[model samples]
Target chain A: MNATLTLTKLDVLRVRRNTRYLILAIAMPAVLYIAVGNSTKQTSGVEFKAYYMLAMATYGAFAGALMNNAARISTERKTGWTRQLQLTPLPGGGYVFSKIVASLVTTIPSVVVVFVLGGTVFHVHMDAWKWVVIALVLWLTSMVFVSLAVAIGYRFDPDATQPAVMLVFFPMAILGGLWFPLEGTLEKIGKWFPTYQAHKLGTDIISTGRISMESVGIIAGWAVVFAALAVVSYRSAQEQ
Target chain B: MSPDTRTPNGAVVEFENVSKTFASPKGPVHAVNGLSMSMQAGQTIAFLGPNGAGKSTSLNMLLGLSRPDSGRVALFGGSASDAIKRGMVGAMLQSGGLMSEVTVREQVQLWAKLHPRPIPVAEALKRANIADLADRRVDKLSGGQQQRVQFAMAIIGDSPLIVLDEPTTGMDVENRQAFWATMRERALEGKTVLFATHYLDEADQFAERVIVINKGRLLADGTAAQIKASAGAKRLSFRLPGVADADLYRLPNLVHVERQADVVRLQTSDSDATLYALLDAGYRPADIEIQALGLEQAFLAITAEDNNHGAGAGAGTGIGNLEAAR
Candidate 1:
């Protein structure tokens, strides 16, 4: 356990040092929110600033969950770092366990950064408990992408993982209404993505004090599918 | 009785009829086939084999990186994973990878913290000769520099059993010397060291025991001199003009028969028997000379014999070709 934690710490430190992760998962969302926070637009029955704040926070968490881990996991396997760890005192599943823990830890910074920007500079207000709940909802639902990252990392090589992540990233960010509020055909399609549902869960909490079963069901369904993919790919990679 | 008789007291490593077959488009490749061997504590063993001769596959099974198809690979009288979880083994694999984005110091430090009882990180770094590159990012270093960093990580745990696969592959002469010196220090401390290397001379000088495998089976296992002896210890040459190839091939214990015109060279397990057979045949060959074979020549002779004899055919011959010196 100590060894796994040490690996976890090292992994977190490595992610923190990655400039690409910072630019994509942390800076981009915060910058985008600041540029569009004060628009005269309403989304999901909440103030434009508050809704956009939730969307950007979800954006940060979602992107943070996917980008760093996918590239790092694929690269580690290719380089034999995973095999190196297996020869250690660390137990089975220790490498993947540490990676997941590190991914969770690294995503915290983005969530906090976006939330603070929204609550302070953008003047979006909410109850203390509401802030905590919304943050938890967005962060927890982003785990779908964490599992997806693991799947992609195991399925592709390091060079391919970048394009693979980008393939998922653009569709989720745009179709999920993270960059802007979606309506008509876009909303109908985007409502099914975990990212869109997670953002809706947060906005509906602020506006209606409740989230729909459909939103919860969509996130949970995607979570199961991605988690299954992660397990299958992880096992296959180990066998090889 | 003693947790299986094969694991005698103080056996640091053991392989019992283990086999592993990998399936490819070409068909199933038997990477390891019923290979069995064991090592005692404090012995420095060199594992030698040709390319695709199951050296890496066996190492992987021993390190618990992959499972054997049949039988068992035991480390310290238990499973490989068990021994590893106890931090009883430290290995530097040929394909084992180093972490990027971390400095050499940080990388070695992380390795030390992962084991049960690790030596000081500074001691490991200095011994591996990477102390000067401590702050340099691992991915930014040269291939040789990265190999040194791996060496440091392998020794950081100070485990009782150390396994190194081609530990000095990218090293210069001086660095190779230093690397062997540190390995000698480890051996002197009563640790069991198993290494596979391409430098046959290093094995001749460093290994207290040499084990050679070919085509997924134990070909030869003994001291370097003993293996040389097994593969016809001496080379005998004589100018026997007009000597029939059949006549030379008839020599007792003949390992190889080579002829260059009137000059006949015979590698024989027993030089005396081979020479007397020629003389006994009423042939007084002029300028008779017998020369001892080096480990390299002996290795070539033995493995070549096996290759010509076929994979399973060499089972009776035990014959390690060690073409790439394992």
Candidate 2:
């Protein structure tokens, strides 16, 4: 357990050392939310900032999980760092778990940035309990995407994994109602995608002031499935 | 334990009928062909082979990074995998498996945590002769410095067995000599050192026992002197201008002779006899030298003989030639 925590801390420190990336991670979603939130007019029965805040928060969490956790792991494997770890007493499970925890830790600042900017600039309103639920839902949703990223990254080589991750990342963000609001035919299609369900759950928790057990169950189910697949893919990759 | 401490004249690492095959586009490619050999504890053994000779594959199997298709690889009298868990083994493979983003200290610390009890960071740095560069990032170091860092990581745990594969790839003669000095010191401290290198001279100078593999088979296994004696050929050179071919060839036990403008070289099985024959033949040459066969010559002879014989009938594996060489 201590080894796992140490490894996770080291990974987080490595990410923090990248000044440009760190700044972008903290600022990008917040900037996008503010710029788009203020310019867009209010929607029927919902304020624009409130909608933008939730979507951008979801985007921030997903990006942090995918880019930080998966991309870094693929690069480590390419450089044979994973093989080095295998030779040590550090278990394979600890390595993967550390990556997940580090991704979650990095996603925190990004989520906070969106909330702070939205609350101050766009007048988004939420009680303490509702805010807590939104944060938990966003984190859980990020876990699912992080697992997916790990699976895809380990399945492909470093050279191919990047383009492959982007291929999945952009579609999920745009089509799954992360970049914009989904309604009518789009909403129906978005419901089929996991990211959309994640974003929907987050928005519902914050705006409706209630937790939907069904959406939470769906997101948790996807997380478990993706995490299992990631473990299998990573182990198979070691053999190859 | 002193690095040079021998393992009580017995096997510390053993491989029994080990064969590893990988699926290729054409068919199954045999990487390790039923290789069986054992290394005594505290003995510095050199595993010499050409490219694709399965040297890396053999080391990988011992490290538990790869498994043999059929056979047992045991380390420290236990399964290879279990040995790895016990932290009884250390390795420096061909590629330096390091994280570029971390500083040297951080990297070393990470590995240190894996061992139940590891040497202090300062002590490890001092031992590896890289104390001053502890805080520097790995990528910032020179090739030799990077190698030193890798070496530091290998010994920090103070494991009983240290396996180094091409550890001196990038070092110059000075650094190579320094590295060898450290290796000898480690061996003297009763640690078993198993290393693989292309430099025959390095192997001859350091390793007590040398194991040569070619085409996925062990070609030779013995002390450097034993290998040289078994091959039975010595190199004789002289700076003799205008020496007649007949006179040079007439030397006793001279299997072959070559003459350049001002130098003549002879391949002989008996250096003492050849020296006496050269003087008896009335040849007065400057800087006359008779050199004993080294590991390089012995290795060449063994591998060449294996190639000529092809795969032997035993188990349809190439390692039969290895046993013959031994």
Q: Which structure among the candidates has the greatest lDDT?
A: 1
Candidate 2 lDDT, A1-240, residue by residue in tens? 777788888888887776655665667888888678885565423576777787888887888788766677787787777877777767668888888888888888888889888778777887877777787778767888878878987887778887887898888788788788777987777676777877677667665665667676766777788889898988788777
Give the residue spans of candidate 2 off by over 4 A: A43-45, B1-10, B237-264, B271-289, B311-326
Candidate 1 per-residue lDDT, tens place, A1-240, comes to: 888899899989888888888998899989988898976676679889998888888888888888778888898899998889888898788888888888888888788898899888878777888888888888788788989999999999999999999998889888888888999999999998888899999998888778789999999999999999999999898878
User: What lDDT does model 1 reach?
Assistant: 0.87
After superposition, the stretches of candidate 1 with alpha carbons farther than 4 Å from their true spots are A36-38, A209-213, B1-8, B237-266, B272-289, B311-326
Clashes of each: 2, 16
* Error in Å for residue B109 of model 1: 1.1
Winner by DockQ: 1
lDDT of each: 0.87, 0.78
TM-score of 1: 0.90
Q: Name the TM-score of candidate 2.
A: 0.88
